[model samples]
Structure formats: C-alpha cells, structure tokens
Target: MGWNPFRRAPLLHVANDVGSGPVVVFIHGIASSSITWTNVIPLLAPGHRCITIDLLGFGGSPAPLDAQYTLPEHVAALARTIRSLRLREPFVLVGHSMGGLIAPRYAARHPGGCGGSCS
Candidate 1:
C-alpha cells in the first residue's frame, strides 16, 4: 500500500515507512519508542519493509497528559495503527519484551489475520 499517515485517539505519533516489501511492524517495549529498533532495522530492511512506531507517551509520540499506560490502551493504539496502515495482507509482527504480551493480545483480537511467534 502507498504511504499513509494515521493516528488513534489517545495516541500521538506518526508511523513512518522505511524500505519496501512485506510489512514488518515492530512494537517496542514499555518505556521505549520506535527508535529503539534503529540498530536492527538495517538488517531486516533487505527482506521486508519495517515500520517502527512510538507508542503513546513515549519517544516522538504523544501520550495523554493524564493517561495511565495500560495493556488495553496500548493494544487499542496498536490495532488502530495496523488498520490505518491498511495491512489487509497478513504481515509478520515482531514485538520485544513487554511487546511480547501486547502483540499476542492484538493477534488474538484479530484472529488468523495475525500470527505471533514469540520467544
């Protein structure tokens, strides 16, 4: 799909596009942002288009001034990002640390559309 920008309520950040191929979205750990994957993007760039994003309240992304970082909130933001990106085709999702939990929840909510192979 072409590059498109989107934002969900309570989340304030733009998901940037890098490279081109099958989409690979990375969800960072708690307290971290998309930049956390800077070191690894190059390695994956050759095979897939990687999209790293800052979750609400972290990195360049904006967080609710009075919002608490809860699992549900994080998952909601993630779902919106995926839909907005229009990744109708099944894409590989890589999550790290706390992302491990959040990613699975997202996959579960979306069913066969997403698959999680966590460590």
Candidate 2:
C-alpha cells in the first residue's frame, strides 16, 4: 500500500493504505471524520484496503467559507476524492447519516459500487 492525496477546492484529506485485495471507501456523517470508522478499520484492514475521509468542513479537511454545504456539494466532494485517489477498481461505499445519502448518489453516478442509506 502507498500514500495518496485527494483535494478539491477547500477540502483536502488523507486515505489510509491497507490490505491486499479490493478497496472499500467509507464516508462519515456530517460533523464526523475519518476517525469515526477507527473501530471498523482494524477489522477490515487485513482483507480489504479501507479509505476513511473527513468530509469537507469536518476534522482534518477544510471547508469553503463561501460555499454552501448542500447534498450535491457533498456528493461531488466524495466523487472528487475517489477520482483524486485514482481508485479505478470496483469498491464498496459505506456511509452514515447524511453520508448515507451522498454515498448512494456517488455509487449511482459510478456504477459497480454499492451504497445504502443508514440511520
């Protein structure tokens, strides 16, 4: 595994490099960051490469003061992060809360990925 950077406008963050097989990107809810999945990462890291990012305006990622934090903005941010990381292979997306909505939109825009809503 190697280091990769993802940046878009006011957002910038890191994705962990782990495992040997496919990749699984996890998006945390509004007000949360990559560390939100800390407990789950250890379990999944051995088998699948996992990515957990701080959404723009949260945690380590920066936010645009002039921009609106809408659903579409989040979806676009997630997509940008994925592409910036150059993750071309099929991957699974797990998101929580508002992220649940953003993840499905991303998967819909980019097929072969799975995403669902959660409380």
Candidate 3:
C-alpha cells in the first residue's frame, strides 16, 4: 500500500534478516504483512535467520494492476521472491491464518525446497 523502506527495492516483500543459522520463513495472515511476526521473529532470530514475507498486495509488497491476487498467484509471487533471495539452503516455513493455508501448498509443490516443517 505504501513505499517499503525496510528492504531494498526488489526485496521489499521480505521482512527482517537477522542472526546466522538455518532460515525460517514467515508468512502473515490475510490483510496483514511480515510485521505480524515482530515479537516471534526476535526469539527465533537468536538461533535462525528470520525471513518474513508480505503476501502479494499486503504489507510492503506492491499490488500491480495486471496480477490477479489468488492463492496460486500469491504462492507464485512468494516463489519469485524467495528465488531472488538465492539462499544457500532450504528453509522452515511458518504461516498464520490464510498464510497457514498457503504455506503447505508451497511446501507440497517444492518438496525438496522445504527442509523443515511448515508450521
């Protein structure tokens, strides 16, 4: 909805990046953004690299005119975002509410890409 000042241009969809260990991806619920994990991220950050996502059209990610916001579309956008990050290994996926529904679908589609449980 607004310009993202958190991360760089392309990675605006992602939230924080802290600590140095295994990765943990967080997907917020409908109508929410990565900020949903503000409290939780710090706890995990101590032992992991926290990467929260702003689902398409929510949070800091832009909402384009041509993109139809759907479950598939959302997942695809997320995939693109993750690919751009170029992480060294698979990550743990965590979601809340609608995001909870989306995470498993992403995990199912990319089985090997997910190293940990989709919580």
TM-score of each predicted structure versus truth: 0.79, 0.80, 0.82
Q: What TM-score would candidate 1 get against the native?
A: 0.79
TM-score of candidate 3 on Cα atoms, chains taken together:
0.82
TM-score head-to-head 1 vs 3, winner: 3
- Lowest lDDT sum, 10 consecutive residues, model 2, at 1-10
The C-alpha local distance difference test score for the whole of candidate 1 amounts to 0.72
**Candidate 2: residue 39 Cα off by (Å):** 0.4
Report lDDT per candidate: 0.72, 0.71, 0.77
Question: Of the candidates numbered 2 and 3, which has the greater lDDT value?
Answer: 3
lDDT of 1 by residue, 35-77 (tens): 7798989998888888887786788876665556677777777
The root-mean-square deviation over C-alpha atoms between each candidate and the true structure, in angstroms, is 7.9, 8.4, 7.0
Best by TM-score: 3
**Per-residue lDDT of 1-119 in model 3, one digit per residue for the tens?**
54333323333377777888999889999878888999998788889998888998888898865555667677777776777777778788888999998899888877877423233
Write one digit per residue (lDDT tens) for candidate 2, span 1-119: 21112334444476565776788888888777878888998999889988887887787776776557776677766766676777656788889887798888887776745322211
Better candidate number, 1 or 2, judged by TM-score? 2
